[model samples]
Target: MNAIEKLQSERQRVVARLAEIDRILGQYEELQRIAESYLASGASHTADSGTVTDSVKTQAEAQREPSVTEPNLPRVKSPKTPMVEFERVVIELLSEAEVPLDRSALYKALLDREIVIGSPDESSDLNTLSARMSRMKDKVVNVSGHGYWPKDRAFLPGGYVPTGVDDMPSQDATSESGLV
Candidate 1:
């Protein structure tokens, strides 16, 4: 083919690829907008058309706590112990307990003492508690099957026997690293 014709064909291909890239970029931008809207409103959204579903709360509504007369309102955040206070409470609870408490039992105790605030949705509270506890390696040890134990005490809670059945890697391992 002639040199000019070949150059034109290459230019056309480049233009077509650029157009395709622009179309893909537009799709990503739309998806990002949809995600931001969903997060801001705490509302469910359909990706295909970016339509709202009826399940979740609006941003304004979520921020405002509903009255008792309005029982069907979306869940709201409850008053919670500040993180520093929460750490103290956990230490106190684990130290005083006669038996090691599993995650669920620990959650119940926190709710009972009002050390950790309760919410309308209990499962979310449990999840939050679990996440917080997972970070507390220096303060507590989650001995498998036995439950949480204060790290400083260096003793298992009463009524828990070492059966050699699901021990941590080693006592020395835990003590040396300051994490069990």
Candidate 2:
């Protein structure tokens, strides 16, 4: 190939690589936003180390097997407590990273910065946070085998123009028939 042809090929390759990098970066940013939203929702609850009080358990049992005249059931108090402060710290870390970070990476980053949320005593806390985000996948982003990415990108949005694919129905062709 001539020098001009060679340079043109190199430029095209560089542009393709840059586009791929941008897509990856975009996925990371979306994940970060999801993590922040989870923390901000105040869903982080701590488990109590102590066993349930005997009186409370007894009362619960009595309510379960009610007499013919009594229909009221005893309300059970949750053993968990909200860790609002810790949640805020985790959210802050996620916001600062502005990228999709695995659980281990996030924990390490927080530790390096001396963030108290993922302290040794609360080693499994980060897992809980991840679980919370995972549960909300449908409403936010689809987090399957590849972690999280915006759903619309995987599936074209309404009136989208698809390119670089095999034979498929054109957007205008479908809409013109009023069949959608």
Best TM-score among the predictions, by candidate number: 1
TM, every model: 0.43, 0.26
How far residue 126's Cα lies from its native spot in candidate 2, in Å, is: 4.7
- Compare the candidates by lDDT and give the number of the best one: 1
Tell me how far the alpha carbon of residue 91 in candidate 1 is from the true structure, in angstroms, after superposition.
0.3
Q: How many pairs of residues collide in each model?
A: 0, 0
149: Cα error in model 1, Å: 0.7
Model 2: residue 120 alpha-carbon error in angstroms: 6.7
Model 1 lDDT per residue over 1-180, tens place: 999988776666555454444544545544454565456556774454422233234444433532222223222223355566677889999988755789889988886765544445778888888888888988787776778877654443332323343544324122333333
lDDT, candidate 2, 1-180, per-residue tens: 999988776666555454444544544543454445457665563534652322323333433432323223332222222244444455565544423356667666655643444323455757665665465444234233233332222222333223333434343233333332
The reply for model 2, stretches above 4 Å from the true place, is: 1-82, 116-126, 129-180
Stretches off by above 4 angstroms in model 1 are 1-77, 117-120, 156-180
Per-model lDDT: 0.59, 0.43
